[model samples]
Target: MVMEIVCPAGTPAALRAAVRAGAHTVYCGFNDETNARNFPGLNFDRSEMREGVDFAHAHGARVLVAINTFPRAGDQSIWHRAIDDAKLSGADAVILADAGLLDYAARTHPGLRLHLSVQAAAANADIINFYAGTFGVKRVVLPRVLSVPEIAAINAETDVETEVFVFGGLCVMAEGRCSLSSYATGLSPNMNGVCSPASHVKYHDNNGELDAKLGGFTIHRAAKDEPAPYPTLCKGCFSAGGQTGHLFEDPVSLNAEQLIPQLQKAGVRALKIEGRQRSKSYVAQVVRNFRAAVDALEAGRPLPEGMLARLSEGQAMTTGAYKKTWR
Candidate 1:
């Protein structure tokens, strides 16, 4: 079967653009602290989600609500209500990472489908199966740490459908558990659904060169004419282990468009595109490109030629751990 292409929609316009560009599903979050990628002027209000769902459904695409962040202590109600509202808004399913929130939804909204978000970092089969059995999760978004063979091994051990990221930003640390951003910016993705938030970034000139700093730490610098990548903590240059470089990962975005066949053969049920903060044009272009790739693959044709490299971060891309070089 052809794998499902799930794209991110930060706005109603992006949602419509993804649908029109041939996304099988578009996932998004509420404009609150309840979901990751909680950036300014992005995400959907309840009304926007409802309208976005209507538009997607009208075009034969599905909407998946992402209530993925862990709830604050003594404040689980907000996350719970986001799930309820997503269902009320006619979302096909809700992506969740917290065990308590998953349990609550399993009990309160028994009929609703649950997809374990990548934020959970349930990489191994033991933990993946545990989540599947514990919360009745229908799908699992594997963390970017697994190789294709490792993913195939996990599929051999579990019945849970798997999803993997195929494009956009890369995280060097496990998605949900990283504190590098919080240690520097004082906002936690676990509690606040934000990482290296734009509000705390500053751009300045240092000795005739441009530098982008995040939370007072110099992340990326460029010569006067070179493009400076965004100051995301994971993609930043830092000295560690006597290496003055992007110790975790270079400032390269994930562009695994070439790995579609291996992933399909490995039993991945869906392909996820990161970047809810992207423009509608970007979202549409990515969806269209991936759609064409998947279509050509389904037709048993060679995967399309290189098309998305120019759109990548720092104009460079990597297949992440899917190819085992990072492992």
Candidate 2:
């Protein structure tokens, strides 16, 4: 089978755009904290999710509702209700990370397909299989910390379908456990479904330099005429050992277009794009490019060269931990 192109859809518009752009699958979440990417003006309302799923199914695409964030203590009903709503809305699958939610879905809605979110960070075969066996997870979205060989090895040991993120922002920390965002902005990705929310971000002109701050901490500084990066804690510049630079990661995106064949050989069932908070036009363009690339790969043609490089706006793009050096 051809590798499925799974695109992110933050809204009804983006969902339609992804489907029309040839996405094999589109993933989105609810507007509330039940899902990640809980940004303002993003995500779908309950009714919108139903309509979006209808639209995707009509276009021959699959819709996955991402109720992936961990439910807070004594607040399980909200997450439970989200899953029930997803089922009622005809979602093809529910991507989840929390053990309680996973167990709930498996026990309460056993017919619904369960996909392990990258937030679970289930990197190796043992744990991936554990999820599959325990919660009946049908797929696992591998974390960003694995190399090609590592991914292949994991695939060799587990029968669960594997999905890997192929493009967009890269996170260096373990996905669900990272608290830097909360420490900086009082918001948590795992609990609250937000990271570096725009509400807490501010940019300042510092004479001949531009400084970007998140929750009052300077994350990036650039020359007046240079492009200033958004102040995401993971990709921030800082001083350590008397050296000032992006200590964790640089302001770069991931572009794995060239590694499609290798990933295919590694038994990956799906390729995921990571920008749910982007514009509809951007989502359409990216889905079209990735769909074409996968089509070419399946037809035994070389993947197109530099098809998505321009989308990064000349920012650095890396293969990240997929090449084996960073681990």
Highest TM-score against the true fold, candidate: 2
Q: Give the Å shift of residue 229 in candidate 2.
A: 1.0
* TM values, all candidates: 0.96, 0.97
What ranges in model 2 sit over 4 Å off? none
Error of 2 at 300 (Å): 1.1
Write candidate 2's Cα lDDT for 1-327 as tens digits. 889999999899999999999999999999999888999999999899999999999989999999989999999999999999999999999999998899999999989999999999998999998999999999999999889999999999999999999999888788789889999999988889998888888988879798889999988888877667756888888988989987887788898988999999999999999999889998999988889899999898888876676566226689888896744
Candidate 2 matches the true fold with a TM-score of: 0.97
Q: Each model's RMSD to truth, in Å?
A: 1.5, 1.4
Question: What are the clashing pairs of model 1?
Answer: none
Q: Residue 144: error of model 2 in Å?
A: 0.6
